[model samples]
Target: MDDRKTLVLTGASRGIGHATVKRFSEAGWRIITCSRHPFSDKCPWPAGEEDHIQLDLADPDGLGTAIADIRARLAANGGRLHALVNNAAISPKGEGGTRLNSIETPMHLWRAVFQVNFFAPIMLGRGLVKELKAARGSVVNVSSIAGGRVHPFAGTAYATSKAALAALTREMAADFGPLGIRVNAIAPGEIDTAILSPGTEALIDDIPLRRLGSPKEVAEAIFFLCSDASSYVNGAEIHVNGGQHV
Candidate 1:
């Protein structure tokens, strides 16, 4: 059996997810990725292309199959999963850069957002608790600043789902702590990603950092939470938002 650590990361094709794959891979950990899209050569990380699993988390259907496939892949390797990063998220918006607040956000859209941002993490974490325990692993959930406060650009469904995900991190930590598993979350502020709309640049001055955070910064925070350096940390959220919340 291989002695290297292993990570199962969602949304690994781009942005922070891609950076995280690079970070862990360079550290000699095996990475298994899940994304809505099929494996693309554009990513080209070590062993990442071959281990990609295509599944749309927002669909909220056939999660059982995803969990099974993930478990099977882990078993095929070393049967130990060191980290599960819930990085997949979806935030829908209308035309002209409008906000989909609580009242205007449709029920179907709300469900889809929650299914991807919140519920999917819950399912994946709990489903693989056994593997995590075997490895004394940690789970890092990707949250957002919108989760803790109202943001003009982020949709209500997206914000609330993240808040719920943060709460779930606490719950998972409390439940899994006895089993030697730690669960934490990182909430990113204004980051430069395809998800950020064109008009978002105007808000840059408000950030203490005076610039949008890079995906690499967020990935480094996630890496800390998954590493022995953060062994004493659990059920907490590290904000990588450059003092946006403060």
Candidate 2:
């Protein structure tokens, strides 16, 4: 029953996930970050400690093993895991892009999108339920506004998967509430992340704010849900989309 707050962050190598890790670190929470690639040598964050683990969320075969390793780390550090952020996702690539009506949206692409967006988060949440229960922790699934809207830019698979994730958030919140575990989601609008491919200028213009969101802004919302500040907030979907979803 160590009193120190610990957070397990996925996709922490960059983007919103990276920003969240930095914020939590500054707030004095011990971080266990996961990424497919090793952090760059120039990574200024204090992730050099033994808590960082490299894991590929898209690799379904390795998901169980990765979760086990994370659980082991928590056990070794003292049975404490305050939060889990399921933020790892892959935007569709190539000529298909993420356009909803694109003829190029193949079954393989759809599968890939669901694999990382939907399956990974569900698997990670189920695997870490015990640790989350131990700390009465929350699970925050990073989703997109495209899930709720019919956006041509988001494509079919990406939007559909995110929509499913939103539903999953509600279900998890309901199921885990009695155990003192909270589940929530953040549906970001258009974040200025590298996830969006180049030549997508038109897509940026469609945003009502006329600009992309900063990763730190999204991170702040996530931090709120992770902390006691949002203790009463459960099964909630906070939109950080600059009024796009409104």
Candidate 3:
């Protein structure tokens, strides 16, 4: 029997998610990743195909299907789940990667952003509650520095969705604490990833670090929240933005 811990992570194709997978996998955790794309042979991890779940979080029905699939996979461990990282998110941009403000953004896009960023996290937490309780697991929701303030590149819908996710993290912590589950959030700023919009370098001077954060840096914080080191931490949002929030 595989006695190693198990983690379910979303948006594992690249960037922060990819870094997170490497972080936990190095610590000998079994990773079950979810992404819109199918398992790629390019992935360095072993059993990548068998452990990857191809599902679009933006689709409500697909998310339900993914949850069922995950639960079945967890059955091997008597329904124990050590960690769940809600990291999949979509930031819609206008022509030439222009920011889409609240008024100018279409209703469909707003709903789509919310479905992926906000609704998916809560739904996943609710769906996996039993497994989490059995393992006394932790949940880490990926938020954004834009969630708290207006970012020059992050769109309005994306920012609002992350804000809602942050709030949901707090609510989930309160409700899941009694079950021995911890819930928290991480807000990243100006991370050097594909998700960053063009002209982001201009904001680096304003940050105290005078540089963009690495995806590994954010992954480290997520790892801490999921591990025993953060056992007493709950309902908190850690800033991985190199003093950008200040």
Candidate 4:
């Protein structure tokens, strides 16, 4: 079995997740990624496709199977899980990249968004608690600035779910602290990801840096929270925005 530290990162096929996979792998850590799509040649991180989990986090009923597979993979690979990055999220849009306000967003859509954005981290953290405790691991949740402040480009469900995720991070830190596990969140603002729409262009002018944030910068923040440099950090939300929160 490979002895490198293992990281289970979700939504690794593109954008922030993709950048995270590269960051961890370059640091000599072994990564196990998952997303809705099947593993392909596109992601070239070390053993990236060899250990990718092709499962949709929105399927709340199917978490048992997903967690079981992940646990098995970790068991096979040195029986340790150093970090789990819950980065997968879905922000559904309507015609013309419209934002679904609180009233217009349907109950089903709300449930789906919460399933991936909030519940998956809970499930993964709970399901993999043993492996995490064994390695004295860390968990970095990928939240968004929408959770803290409303964004014209992001829908209501997405913002609320991310808010809940940040809250959940606090709860998780309290619960997992005794077991030597650290839990934290990174709240990004207007990163150049595929999920962006034309409406995002206007928000850049409001940014203090006068530029959009990069996936690599967010990935570096994630890496810090997971690495020993931030070992004392827990239940904190690191903003990756270009001073947009200011």
Candidate 5:
């Protein structure tokens, strides 16, 4: 097996996922990234050198195939996957103008939000547990403060799905810890990402920090959790919200 560590990251097209890929790449770890979109021609990272897969996480049936492909790639490279980062998520469409309990919060919106935010990651993690256990790997679920609090800025579907994700993190940690696998979560406040719609400015003003976090900052926390640096840390939720919840 290659001595270098390997990581399988989802939602790597941009934002926090992109930052994480760059950080791990710089640290000499092999990275395999997946996204719904094809790799961009203008992608700053070197093409063909790193592993990049295209698949929509929302497709439940395809997740198994995607995981198998990732495992095969890792085996071909003579490396074991040391971490799984579940960073892909989508807010409800047309949620920008809707309030938390707005009548417009349709069931389809909730289903779509949960499909990506809660279900996909849990399913993928469960599928990859064996590889992760063998390598004593960790699973980092990207979550939000909205999960813990009732905020107008976060729609019902988005907030509720994230809360479920956080609970899933704890459950996974408990179930996987006996096997030397760690599970944790990061709840970011207002990060500067295109994921946020236009009306987010009003919500940003409520944050005590008065500014948004960078993708790199969030990626840093993920790296620490994935690495031996946080060996004793498991089943913990790290808040990167600049005291937004405190």
Candidate 6:
């Protein structure tokens, strides 16, 4: 029997998602990654092309097709999915990368944000429940510190979508627990990524750590939640912000 674990991760092209792909791949886990862009020839991961899926999670129709395609790919793993990480998200900004407040954010953009950040996770989870159950899988939703409180950089749409994702994580944990599946969330703060705004450096001094968090740090927390170390942990939202929440 092929006992190697498998993970289905979204948004694996960059930042925390990229770090996560490296972490799991190094651990000898088979990784299936989803992204809006096609697999790049320069991708460093092994079997990157074959294991990569081009998916636009915002389109419900496209997502449905992608789900089926993902299931087909999982057949080689005996229809087992050890982990599902809903890490793809979008944070739209105005000109000069300014925050888009509630009043100014367009309705289309707000809905688009929700579609990717909120709806996609649930849709993918529901679509892959069978595979998840087969492997007694863990699901990790990537949220943000902005979900709980206002942040200067994170826009209104992005913040609300993450908050919704956090809520959905708790609800999924309750519903999936009995099936031997775990669901959790990680709320990150001020991570050093391209997603950060131009003025992010100014806020670092206010952070308790007095520095920005690395993508690898967040990936480590995610690895823990998906691994046996967090077997009993469910419906929990772990904070990856270095005491910034305090």
Provide the TM-score for each candidate, comma-separated: 0.97, 0.91, 0.98, 0.97, 0.91, 0.98
* Residues 1-246, model 5: lDDT tens digits: 578788888898888998988888888887888899887765565442357889888888788899888878877645356999999888754543556454678887788789889998888788887788778999999999889998766788888899999999999999999989999999988888877656667776777888888999999999999999999899999999878887
Model 5 per-residue lDDT at 84: 94
lDDT rank order: 3, 6, 4, 1, 2, 5
* Candidate 3 lDDT tens digits, 133-238: 9999999999999999998888999999999999999999999999999999999988998766778899999899999999999999999999999999999999
Per residue, candidate 2 scores C-alpha lDDT tens digits across 1-246 of: 445688998888788988898898898888888888886664556644577788887888788899999898889656668899999887675554535444667898888889999999989988988999988899999988988987757777888899999999999999989999999999998788777655546666666777789999999999999999999999999999777765
lDDT of 1 by residue, 110-145 (tens): 989989999999999989998999999999999999
Residue 6, candidate 3: C-alpha displacement in angstroms: 0.5
Query: lDDT of model 6 at residue 195?
Result: 69
**lDDT of every predicted structure (CA atoms):** 0.91, 0.85, 0.94, 0.91, 0.84, 0.94
Task: Count clashing residue pairs in model 3.
Answer: 0
TM-score of 2: 0.91
Mark the 10 consecutive residues where model 2 has the least summed lDDT: 93-102
Preferred candidate (lDDT higher): 2 or 4: 4
**TM-score (C-alpha, index-matched) for candidate 1:** 0.97
lDDT of 6 by residue, 45-75 (tens): 7888999999988899999999999999888
Residue 161 local lDDT, model 6:
98
Candidate 4 vs 6: which has more TM-score? 6
lDDT computed for candidate 4? 0.91
TM-score of 3: 0.98
Residue 215 of model 5 has an lDDT of 95
The residue pairs that clash in candidate 5, if any, are none
